[model samples]
Target chain A: MNFFACENLSAGYGRKEVLKNITLSFEKGRIASVIGPNGSGKSTLLKCMGRLLKPSAGCVYLDGRSISSMTDSAIARSVGILPQSPSAPGDIPVHCLVAYGRNPHKKALSSFTKEDRETVEWAMHATGLQDKRFLRLGQLSGGERQRAWIAMALAQRPQILLLDEPTTYLDIHHQFEVLELLEKLNTSCGLTVVMVMHDLNLASKFSGRLIAMKDGQVLLDGCAEEVLTEENIFDIFRVKSRIVDMDGSRAAMYMGVA
Target chain B: MREITDSDAKRRLMTGAAGLMLLAAGFVVSVITGTVDISVGDMARIFTGVQTDGMYHVLMNIRLPRIITGAFVGVNLALSGAILQAVLKNPLADPGIVGVTAGAGLFAMAVMILLPSFTHLVPPAAFIGAFVTSLVIYFLAYDGGAHPLRLILAGVALAAFLGAFMSSLTVLYSDRVQGTVNWMAGSLSGKSWIHVKMILPYTLLGLFGAGIGARYLNILMLGDDVARGLGLSVERVKFMLTMLAALLAASAVSVAGLLGFVGLIVPHITRLIIGSDNRFLIPFSAVFGGIIVIFADTAARVVFAPYELPVGVVMAFVGAPFFLYLLSRSSRS
Candidate 1:
């Protein structure tokens, strides 16, 4: 069964409709990657799906229930979102930033329970941030900061995680590290993952499913092998590419001789 | 990265302890100094409502009211600055700097000049003016609920306008300007128990609002987009903090005139000394501010004796240079 579904949902900011009538569903325990060129409304779509942005029309259903009827905390508990470039003001400790993820689970005057501490520790461990937990965020490198943010989202312990360009600022090694960590979480915890990526190859390699968006609408949605086609690439991104079978896997390598 | 040395932690603890002790000392010192200097023993007796000739009147009336007013002014100003910094997401966005204090001061001046008999109406009028001015700034700065330049620009414009109006009022009505000069310039002199009584309620309310809102402010300092993803109602938090900040500022202005720098500098100082956790910063900033203003008032009185300078002037004299140094250092960083 689908864990979350968006039906004919249109969303935007004040008179500018960024996301057109688009429909999609995230299944349980699957890595779904949304990929498109610039201005594809990829981030907007993730925001809408994550319930960060209210849809202009239609509805989002979580476990077959209307998302609009749910409280913010409830939605937050179910879906964790990490937007591109999540920045806190000067020198927030890594542990404190991660602790904020537990805010949804906490009430006023209540201390962090044993489970909360364990989850926080688990999140730190998963993100490879255990040793740096006490360090200030500003003192960390870009990749480290990004990992700290991911650790914060992980601490939310949500069933679904939505990331908008999570690998943007990282080096290639760190990008793969983060992606690998995310993949492990999806596999081990049965957590449904949705992420937006600019690198078509990375998306194809990491995600089980691919969603291609163009101008606030979903253009294609299928398995990575099926959707990463030459025709789809040309039609969606206006890029000339050849889909070659490389070592029993489909690879779309761009050619200058279009 | 520098090591988290044992001395570093010890030094921090020592500084925190010193800051607290200084605040307590300031309070005691403020209680003792007045037209007639009170001994520590007599001042203690006065608190118990015991009668003594020389120091008793000073303790009961002059010094006590001034001390309370100074403490309230300090706390209100600091919290106002802290709240504005959090709401506007800029360290320089103190209520005074953003024209809220000027707006309140101008309105209070107009009230005294035109509607002198309605003295009770001054604080409310000043509050309304401050709120309206800040609201205008907020709207102008907001584009789909996020405004960066508009707040600073609108604040500058409103502050200029109110400042000009105050000057114009002083120019147009010179006779009414004497009381206006002293009041607008800010003085604790001639303050009575009634003034203390009037300010206590507003100060208490502002403190309560700030205490409740501090956690939200800490969340907000994570920037707007992150704050939203963290399930903070960003717009709501900003609105609530803005209101609370303006209320605190307006009340402070109404009581102590335009005591500068307490609002502008104390929060940054607190941030530099400790981490920017509002839970600790807010109350500590309140204390630091209270101490600064009380000492400033004391200096204002004692430095020139009977020809006492306004406490606001004393604050500006000390704060402006410190603020500039901070500005230069921050810019370099």
Candidate 2:
């Protein structure tokens, strides 16, 4: 069964209509990436799927249940989402931030259970942030901070994870580190992963499926070999590009404007 | 990671315990150091049902009620400020700075002036005024949403307007000027058990509500989009927390007039010791805020001996400088 899907989803901020008539689905245990040019409604589509923005026109489903009908805690348990450019109070320690992800699972006024602590520790260990758990967020490098946020989402123990531009502000090395981390989680834990990506080459290399968006609509949905072709890149991004074979993976190398 | 979290938890526990101790000390100091100068032994005797008539009368009727009222008022204001700061994601958010107190004061003055016969209605009226003013500030700050800087600016403007209106009402009512001025100065002077009774239920209810809402507040600090993405009902939680904050502030204002600085400073100080986790911060702020107010009120009564200054004046003297220091330090950092 598909782990997540959205049908006829249209959303916007105050009638601006950033996403229109979008229908998409992601199967369980697959890593999918949404790639698009600036202002092509990529982030908006992710927000709609994550239930951060209510659709003006349709519904989102998680594990065969309509998201709108699910209780907030129910949806939280099934799907964890990390928004682009997430922030926390500056002085909060990494461990505390990650522990907050257990919020959906715990009752009010209840102390953390043994299971909750294990989950938090597992998240920190997965993200390689055990050493920095006591450090304040403001004291971390940019990549570490991003990992802290991902660790926070992982602590939720969701079957599906949605991320928006998770690598936007990082250096190239850090960017790949994050993508590789997600890849590991996807392959090992069978965590169905969906992320919005700006780097076409990185997206092509890491994602099992790629969905290209243009003007608030899906332009292409296929594997890298189908979606990362030169003609498709020009048509969607209005830029000329070359497809290069590197290390048994396809990479899109942009040349010049179309 | 486990060790670090364990230590952090230990630190929080220590801070909370210390705060409670300080609050108890402040309570004893307030009871013992009044004009009559009752000793600890005298206090013990009075409590043990020894008929030390004058000391017992003073402790039970006047000093105990006044100190308890101050403590409750402090707790209410501090918790209100902490909630506002977290929900609005603004460090400068306090009832006094954001005009919540002024709004309450406005309606409270109106009640005293126009509906003098219905004095019992003042708290509710003040609550309405505070709720309305907060809504006005909230909407005005909201372009797409309430930015921290925009919210502060709107609060300042609204506070100025309400402060002016309140001043005008005081002037127009010449006959009631003395009482109004004392109340406006945020005095806990002349409070009896009746005033304590009036505020206790609201204070308890507000604190309980804030304690329950701390988890939501933790999510809220992560920004709105992130909060919603985490499966929180962002708008609903924000509305509920804002109303809770306004209720707490209005209750404090009604009982204690316009106590400033306690709300603004106590939360920051508590955050310094306990960090920003509302679960710990809320209760710590309540206790520390109570301690500060009791001490400040005690100073207000004893510092000048023959003449007493309004406790609000004492707070302003300390609070204004501390606020400026924090502002400069933050800017530098």
DockQ of 1: 0.44
Model 1, residue pairs in steric clash: none
Tell me the tens digit of each residue's lDDT in model 2 across B1-333. Answer: 567667878998888788888888998889999789798988889888985688899998999999999999999999999998898787777986456887888998898887788877876787778778988887888775556677778988998998898788877887876656666678888888988988898789888999899988998999987776566777778777877888788878887777899889999998888788898989888888889999999999999987888899999999999999999988998
- lDDT of residue A256 for candidate 1: 48
Fnat for every candidate: 0.41, 0.66
Q: On a 0 to 1 TM-score scale, where does candidate 2 land against the true structure?
A: 0.93
Q: How would the docking of model 1 be graded?
A: acceptable
Stretches > 4 Å off in candidate 2: B1-7, B97-99, B115-124, B135-157, B174-176
* lDDT value, residue B264 of candidate 1: 83
> Which runs in model 1 stand beyond 4 Å of their true positions?
A247-249, B1-12, B41-51, B97-99, B116-121, B135-149
Q: TM-score chain B for all models.
A: 0.91, 0.91
Task: Return the lDDT, model 2, position B211.
Answer: 87
User: What does candidate 2's lDDT look like per residue over A17-107, in tens digits?
Assistant: 9898999989999989999999999999998888877889998988777998987777888788998888888888998899988888877
